[model samples]
Target chain A: MREDFQDELTRVNRTLVTMAKAVREAMRQASSALLTSDHTMAQQVTARDAEIDVLYRVVEDRVYDLVARQQPVAGELRKVLTALQVAADLERMGDLSVHVARAALRRHPAPAVVPELADLFREMSTVADGLAAKIVSALADQDAVLAAQLDRDDDAMDHLHRELFSVMLSPRWPLGVEAAIDGALLGRYYERYADHAVNVGHFVVFLASGKDD
Target chain B: MREDFQDELTRVNRTLVTMAKAVREAMRQASSALLTSDHTMAQQVTARDAEIDVLYRVVEDRVYDLVARQQPVAGELRKVLTALQVAADLERMGDLSVHVARAALRRHPAPAVVPELADLFREMSTVADGLAAKIVSALADQDAVLAAQLDRDDDAMDHLHRELFSVMLSPRWPLGVEAAIDGALLGRYYERYADHAVNVGHFVVFLASGKDD
Candidate 1:
């Protein structure tokens, strides 16, 4: 019975890792859609979000079932609970991607705001991509150090976010009010996406620590 | 041993309920500061945020410990996980309040940013307060239907947010750049707070449904 429970728990973790990967891919594609004006890619990212949503439900169900049946000890329980939180964060990340995709669709062929936003978008993409990779590595290798670094990396994203805001506020920029709104919202979505990735990294740190303290 | 685990879980739930109440009060105080331009009240809200943060960390630790030790089954696990998510959301709500308080502090006597903004602030506070109240009650009563209604209430907040943006964009509003930026950020903070409240309501629904579907 113990071995069977362990197997089930591992399965759930694997599924969560897969969901995280899918969410990361969705974010990257959505960013590409925004940068390259690829509505097709944006559409793809939007459609894939439903898949992450489905996986979220699956993981939640399985983890709860495992907890009920196995009555896992403290360490295992933390793992399952952390997995649930991570799944929700990943799902939110997917939603962020969908938001980006919708924004792209609305601004197809790329708006003039792209010049002001391109650098921030690129830097955000790198940070998001790196954070996603680290999460996967942390889970696979159980490396808490890499997970810890994610928080620091988030600082860079935050700096870029402030810079983006300053640009929006600058009177020198000739972008009209509509373009400014789009840029601001777009910046916000990126910042939020990175924030969620940092949150996932925190979960990984908790899992690696193997104790609440 | 199983009975002891159940008792401990109940204790955790009780504590979470208390923390939620504290967070809701913090939000109310923060909004009051904004609406009434009460700088002292705003400072108090900011000071109290640290307490919310501490409570959040403590609850998180307890939840992690409980899960690892008790190995709760399906419903029990969902309850704990839901509590964890709600804790994060409540903490974020507190952060939003802090943001509002900071904005209040910046404006001092409160800059008149177009007549529409005052109305928008009033509408936002009402909706945000309602959403927070509903979430706390839904969690307390395990009421899914009420939670769903809270989700609908979020739409009104979103509409007000967009309308605020429209006001900023209109040439008629002479509150030029700085006020517009402040107004925009302020609106965003309120919208985000409402969004987090809706998230808590969703968790209440999940707990009630026993299925993530």
Candidate 2:
């Protein structure tokens, strides 16, 4: 019975890793759609978001069932609870990715990211993807050190977020109100995607270290 | 022992209600700060956000202890888990309020909401506060009916969010890129606050009905 419970716990962690990978792919597709004005790709990202949501539901239901049946205590309970929080953070990352995709769809054919700002967004995408990857590694390996590093990785995303705003608010910015608003909201979505990835990493850290810091 | 566990559960619920109240007050202060350009008030709101974080930590620790010690199952376990999710949503609501306050600070000595859009933002603020209040009532009473209504209440917030965007994107919009960006982000912050509130309500519904939908 104990071994069976342990297997269930391992399965839960594996599911979190899978969810993180899906979110990373969603963000990747969303970023590509935005930069290239690929309407079909953007539509695909938006549609696949429901798949991420389904994975989230699966994690939540499994955790509930495990705890109810096993009555896991101490370390085991913390791991189960952390899985739920991590799934939630991953689910929110998927939503933010959809937000990015919709921004692309809203200005279809015309790039959602103007050319001058395109490089900046691409850099943001890199950082976001990196953070998501770290979340997967941290969860799959239960590496608290890797998880702790996400906060520093998130700093790069934040810096890029501010850089995007600086470009938009510059006096020489040629884009008018509409483009500026799009840039602002898109910057927020990418930044928030990084934030959720960091949150999931923190849950991994908490699970490993038994420290909620 | 069961009676003691029940009392601890009651304490957890009460703490969630208190956290929701704090989040509501934070949002109210943030809106006032943004509209009035009250630098001091905005500063206060930003500084006081830690208090909300403290409340969040309290809920998490208490819930963890409750679950580990009591080994609750069935409805009791669900209630404990739901409390954790609700506390997280409320804590995030607090962060969004800080974001609004920061926007006001960024444009200190000048109103964040221009005079023309001031009425719309005020309406958003009212809806945001109302949602927070409903979260409090829903959690305190465990009223699935009241909790179920938050989705509709959130529609009003979504409408205002889109309205704010439309005004900023209009051809005749007088505000420059900076102000438009500010408006876009502020609208998003308020809209997300409502989203978190709705999430809390859903958890309440789940707690009462055992249905996650």
Candidate 3:
């Protein structure tokens, strides 16, 4: 209820949204690189991950400082602690984006997703971006509704991931072993990116409801 | 330090070890089931995962209560926060073991790993168990040395994972698409299981030396 607490909480919330945006951009660029075989874009996403780590550290320090100084118990404590968790989730979402980029980088000059499965991966990226935006809005507005919707979006991601698996497992699969590995792993990266976004959503719900679930 | 705080810290520490042991057992049994085609053991590992989740919640509640009630700062604060991080890592480690088990169960009546790759997965499981033991000991003794060694062990696990990849991508890969998916995913479960163990080690080092490396 303190004015100082309110100001600091707003700062944390702003930082979280900014961090989410950074990760969302990374995811988009990384997916673009994968779909288009843009080596330069992939490299950029991979290189930019260090900056995301710096943001993560900044959020962590702010959350810890809030707790150490204010010692806010009850709902205040939940809010402070959930900030740390949400920051971690966002940071990992950034890392998953980098992993997608790395997959592209690992097979440079050649796309990781085969022509047949490219559309599915493209859809996955779009869903991931949507979830990231929802998470940012959910955190900023403390909207548990938006946060919970991320799970449904994540379900869409999981379905795409499974579809990706079937492509690799199809009897008439044309891609070689290398493409199979790349596609499988690339699909997983996007799937995990969405999962982390959902995790942030759940953290927002926890912040709003004081429920760990 | 207050006596009651120390007592509660010890309780949390003990539950962490117990939880680690459960996950270790799960990892061992899951790997055994995969290597030996023991369906019952695979089922057991998957079934026991719920218990690990219960332990994770207990640790979370205790760590949060310690921070809220004790208002620990500085070193005490680091201890409480690191406890939370460590619990999350161990819980993920348990899930990874379940993943390994699920791999085996999905291929029921058939061994997931061919004779060629069984040895490598077995070695990975052994290495993971060794790392889990080191982590539990490090936490119990607060030994930075043991904690640091886990990263090195994790490197070994990664080496094995790369080796598994080479086998999957070999020119003469004997397995079909379905088997390849199972092998690749199972190998990853063990590799990632080790990675989470290393994460816990880093958390231990952070707790011991106040360095977040």
Candidate 4:
């Protein structure tokens, strides 16, 4: 019975890791599709979101079943609960990626980022993708230390987000209202995507430390 | 022992209801502050956020302890888990309210909303506060039907959001880039606050239904 419970716990972690990978790929595809105005890729991200949603719902169901059946206590309960939160964070990641993709799709042939702001957005994409990779590693390794590092990594995205705002709010901003709106929203989507990664990482650290009251 | 667990579950629900009330009040103050340029109210919202954050952290710790010690199962397990998710949704509602308050605070001397959009924002505030109230009642009653109704309530806010965007994005927008940015972002903050309320409601419905796979 104990061995069966342990195997179920391992399966939970594996499912979480799989979901994390899917989230990272979603971000990557969405970011690339946004930057390049790759309609097909953007469409792909939009289409794939349903699958990610299904995976997220499946994870939630699994967590509920594990808790009900195993009645896991202490460290085991914490791990299972953390998996639920992490899956939620990843689910948002996927949703935000879809948001990014929709922005691209909304303006098909025309790239969402105007010329002056393209480089800034490209930088944000790098920050977001880097953080997504870190989230995957942190989940797989249960590396609280590395997961802790993701908070600092998120600061870079925040800085870039502020930088994007600076351009949008600048008196000399030539992009006008529509493009500025697009730029601001996209900057936020990427920054928020990174923030969710940090959230998942924080949950990992909490479970790793088991330091709750 | 079983009675103790049930009592703890009751305590969890009470704390969540308290948190829900706090979140509702926070939105009221923040929205009033935003519309009126009430610097003191805005400052209060910012200061009060720390307390809300503390409450959120405390609720998290309490949930962890309950889950660890009780090892609740079936309906009991679902209720405990649902409380955790609901608390999180309320926590985010608090954060979004803080964002609204800060937007007001940032433009202390000058009101954030221009005169034309001010009435629109004031209307949005009314919708948000109404939704927040509904969330609290939903949590208190565990009324999945009432909770489900809040999603439709959120549509009013979404409509207002689109109304605000229409003004900001139109070619005739007299307000320059900065004000437009403020309007756009504030609209979003309010819309998201309502969305979180919907999320809390949905969780309530899920728990009430006891439909986890």
Candidate 5:
């Protein structure tokens, strides 16, 4: 029974890693859509979000099932609960990606990002992509060290987020209020996506260390 | 043993209700600070956020302890899990309130919200307060009917959120880009607070009905 339970746990972990990968790809595509104003890619990212939600549900049900069947205690139980949290953070990351895509769609036929802010958005996207990749590796290997580093990596995203606001509010900013609002909100989406990734990393650290610190 | 477990669950539910009340109060104060630019009130709201975070950690730890000690299964296990989720949502609501307060603090001496949008912000605050109240009652009573009503109630917040953007983007808008950005981000924070409240309501419905839908 113990061995069977471990097998199921392993399968659940694999699903989490797969969900992370899907979220990473979603954000990457959503960023491209926003920068290039590619309506099709933006729509694709929004549509594919359902798949990530489905994966989240899968993880949730399996964790509950494991709890009911095996009554896992102590460390094993913490591992299961952490899996649930990691999946939830990934699910939210997926939603944040959709928000970026929808922002692109909202300004369809026109560029969502202005030329002045394009480089900043590109940098934010790069930081977001790197954070998502780290989340994948942290979950797949249960590497607490890698997970701990996501916090520092997320700082880059935050820095870019502040820069986005500064640039939009600059006197030289030639864009109208509409573009400024779009830039502010889009920067928020990427920043939040990175925050959620860091949250997942913390859960991975807890799973590895069996301590909530 | 079963009765003892029931008593503990009741205590956890009460903690959740208390946490909800605290979050509601935080948003109320935060809104007042934003509209009035009352720096002291804003500081108080930010300072007290740590208390909400403490309550959230309490809920998390207690739920884990209950799971380990009792190994609750089936419906009871689901109840425990739902409690964890409800606490998490409430904790996030507290953070959203801080976001509003910080917006106010960032522009101290000058109102965070311009006079043009004051009425609209007041309305958003009212809706947010209403949502938080519903969350409290829903958790306290485990009233699925009341919980289900939150979705429709949230539409008011959504409408206000859209109106916020329209007001900022209007050709006649008198504010500069900084105020527009502030308005946009503040609106997003309030909208997300409403969304999290709705999420908690869904969890309450699940707890009462034994169905995820």
Candidate 6:
């Protein structure tokens, strides 16, 4: 029975990892859609959010069942509860991707931000995607070290976010006020996405340390 | 032993209710500060957030201990977990109040927005304060009906947030670009606070209904 419970728990983790991967892909696709003003890809990412939502609900139900039936002790209970919270965060991340896609759709055929700003966004997306991947791996392997490294990666995203804001605030960009607002919001979304990934890494660290910090 | 566990859980609930009340009061103080441009009150609210944080951590530790040692089942586990999550939401609400206070500080000696916009913010704060109070009571009493009602109250906040944005977007505001950006961010913060309160209500409904939806 214990082995079966572990198997079920592993299955849930696998689902979460897959969900994280999908979110990362969705983000990349949404960014491309934004750069190219591809309405079709933007719509595709928006539509795919339902899959993330469904997975979230499924994982939540399973975690609740595990707690109820297994009466998970100490480390096991922490793992399940963290998984539940991370699932909620991941689902929200998916929603943010949809938000980005919708914004892309709204401004389609418009000129992109200068190549520099575009590069900054691409770099932000790449860091976020890397952080998401590391979180999944950390959880799967219970690697506290890797999780800690992901936490540091979040700092890089923050720095990039601040840099983006500085650019928006600077007089160098002849971008209109509306463009600046959009850029600020986009930078915020990316920074927040990275923050959530760091949150997941913190959960992993807590599980490994057996202490909530 | 079960009775003792129940009693301890009750203590946790009592502390949570107290913490929620404190947070609501802090939010009220912050709004009053904003309305009056009272730096003292704003500072007071900001200072009180640490107390809320400390209380939240204590409640969190106790809840985890209860779950680990008592091994609560079914309804009991649900109740405990709901309390834990609600505590977290309340803490975040407190943080939001601090954000408002900081904003208030930035605009001290005179109201930040124009009179009409300030009134809108005042109204948002009132709804937010009321929503927090209702969520606390709903959780304390296990009143799903009250919780659902609070959920609807969130709509008023959403409307105000949209109106704030519309005001920002309008060409009428002489404050120009900076005001629009500040208004947008402030509106977003309030909307998110209301959303968290609604989330607390959803958790209450979940506890009462035993269903994820």
Name the best candidate (by DockQ).
Answer: 5
Per-residue lDDT of B196 in model 5: 97
**Recovered native contacts, candidate 1:** 0.57
lDDT of 1 by residue, A1-213 (tens): 889876997798788789878988998898888888888998999888889999999998887788777877656766767788888888999999898889889878765246866887788778878887887787666678888898887898899888887887787866666666677777778888888888888888788787542
RMSD of 5: 1.1
| Model 2: per-residue Cα lDDT over A103-123, one tens digit each | 999998888899989999999
Model 1 chain A: which ten-residue window has the lowest total lDDT? A108-117
The CAPRI category of model 6 is acceptable
DockQ of all predictions against the true structure, Cα-based: 0.51, 0.81, 0.63, 0.63, 0.85, 0.43
- Greater DockQ among 2 and 6 belongs to 2
**Chain A (candidate 1) TM-score to true chain A:** 0.94
Score chain A of model 4 by TM-score against the reference chain A. Answer: 0.95
Model 3 TM-score on chain A: 0.95
Question: Arrange candidates by DockQ, highest first: which order?
Answer: 5, 2, 4, 3, 1, 6
Writing each residue's lDDT as its tens digit, candidate 1 over B65-157 gives: 877776666667677777788888888999988988888887878642335578888888889889888887887787889989986789999
Identify the candidate with maximal TM-score: 5
Model with the higher lDDT, candidate 3 or 6: 3
Native contacts retained, all candidates in order: 0.57, 0.80, 0.41, 0.59, 0.76, 0.24
Cα lDDT computed for each candidate against the true fold: 0.81, 0.90, 0.86, 0.85, 0.92, 0.80
* Better structure of 2 and 4 per lDDT: 2
Candidate 6: residue B58 Cα off by (Å): 2.7
Enumerate residue pairs that collide in model 3. Answer: none
Candidate 5 per-residue lDDT, tens place, A1-213, comes to: 899789989889999999999999999999999999999999999999999999999998899999999888878888898888888889999999999999999999899998999999999999999999998998899899999999887988888888888888889988899999999889889988998998998888888888875
Tens-digit lDDT track of model 5 for B1-213: 899789888989999999999999999999999998999999999999999999998998888888998888888998898898899889999999999999999999999898989999999999999999999999899999999999887999999998998899899998899989889999999999999999999999998898986
Clashing residue pairs for model 4: none
For B1-213, candidate 2 gives per-residue lDDT tens digits of 799888998898899999999999999999999999999999998999999899988998899899888888877888888888888899999999999999899888878888878999999999999999999999899899999999998999999988998888888887798888888888889899999999999998888788877
- Model 4 misplacement above 4 A: A1-5, B1-3, B211-213
TM-score of candidate 6 to 2 decimals: 0.89
- Tell me how much of the true interface, by contacts, candidate 5 captures: 0.76
Q: What lDDT does model 1 reach?
A: 0.81
